[model samples]
Target: MEHDLPPVLSLDIGGTKLAAGVVTFDGLIHGWQITPTRREEGPRPVLARLFDLGRKAVAEAGLPEVAAVGISCGGPLDTATGVLECPPHLPGWIDVPVGPMASEAFGVPYALENDATAAALGEFRYGAGRGTSTMLYLTISTGVGGGSVIGGRLHRGAAGNGGELGHVMVRPGGRRCSCGRLGCLEAYASGTSIAERAREALAAGRASSLSAVELPTAEDVSLAAAAGDPLATEIWDETTWALGSALTDLVNAFEPELVVLGGGVTRSGAMLLDPVRAAVARDAMPPAARAARIEPARLGAGVGVVGAGAVAHDLLLSGKSDA
Candidate 1:
């Protein structure tokens, strides 16, 4: 049945970039296009460009039309209403009616989902989580966010933003998170936080290989840690600890069959995976730990487009959207 579904237009809106593509049911993207978001221009102009990008993608993919359109963006959103509610990444964006606007622009139904939630579904349906009925997906990029699939279904949670898993408290009063909370997983494990911590350590007169770079990033810290830099190692260890601790709690609570880690930070590969895996293994409840296998995400840079596509396909399949 999935193979019979028509292709859909997928759009991903991010703080820094906008991506559009035509995605087939098999999780393959065609005619992918990307551009700077320039969010300062505000939602109206940005959405217009995103719609144009979708048209371009459809044209380039050689499809006369798509079944529907799917949209993925950062959360603090209302999925039922298809409105973006002040996502932190897009500071000035308020209650933008993304779903309706998208549908009107393309003359087709649209499904708007939290970026991480859609990514989770994408992974579960087509990526590393293909065979798993219960799984957790975390994207440790500019910010840490996650979503869960339970009993072979995506869990949208009460407010439609999924679980907001990044907000889970890992250390009380340890660091100020973007959510204004202290010690949230996002405050330590996010790529932004990793770079910030490394920069702060250098500013505080700590020595490390990271000092050679004018502005060290999470990738820099990862590289330095792998090369045996003391300060970098300290920060990296703390990052992995925060992730492992948070994941352990999640595993104990949800007992998912797999935990797939994605996003820009995951590019560090085993440098990030090995320690976090070890931590969850050592600290999680024995049964939960045994049931869960942490693995890297299979979809790479195109995940956002593929994720949006997957959401659209689900919408069509559910009879909630016309094809």
Candidate 2:
């Protein structure tokens, strides 16, 4: 029965882009296609475009048919009912029934997962967490998000979205988070926060090399910091400090064997990882610190699509609802 399952069509929805791929049971992807999300167009148009992307991916892969579709997107979503509640990234897109729509479009069942949770499963199954019993994954892109695999199983928690690791309180009464909370790790370590802090500093007229650039991004800050720009250094340090502090807490709490960091921010590689590693080594409980190794994600930019495909593959195997 398991061998009879068809390859899965996977879609990943993000604020900046939409990606689709045909994924086999082996966790390999083929016929991947990517396009800008252009979310200003609202849900109907975006979903239509997304479905079209799916069809294109299916056609490109030369598969006869796909058995299931798996969708991954940012949360505040209902995995049980497959409704996407107002995720802050996709502003003006609220309560869209993406799962049913995707299922209907494809004539197959669909599984919707929080992007980070699906990524965690992705890493656990095929990336850095492979063969490990417990692992954690964090994505530090436009926002910070996290998920955990514990006791050799994906942990979705009671809320369906397993862990809001980014929401960990790093500075009480400090910067406001998109979750409407103050002092969240996401408030400080996310790429958006890095750029905002740089912009705020520049707006206040702090003289720095970044002053010459308009709307610098986190990569810009990282590059500037690497080039010895003081302002960028400050921002980069604070970002790493926040990540280390939060990761220290998470490593202590979970005692995972590995922690995988992904997303656009991690492109800085050693610049981002070395400092966090140092902080965790210095601050976390000795046992937990010794147990966990933080590393960059192996799946790279395609993790979202692959993760969604993995979710669909799981659906085929289980024939049951997600946690």
Note the Cα lDDT for every prediction shown.
0.93, 0.92
Clash pairs (backbone) in predicted model 2:
none
Positional deviation of residue 95's Cα in model 2 after best superposition, in angstroms: 1.4
Q: Quick one: how many clashes does candidate 2 have?
A: 0
Candidate 1, TM-score vs. the true structure? Answer: 0.98
For this target, which candidate reaches the highest TM-score against the unseen true structure? 1
Q: List the residue pairs that clash in candidate 1.
A: none
On a 0 to 100 scale, what is the lDDT of residue 67 in model 1?
83
lDDT of 2 at 241: 94
Local lDDT at 55 for model 1: 89
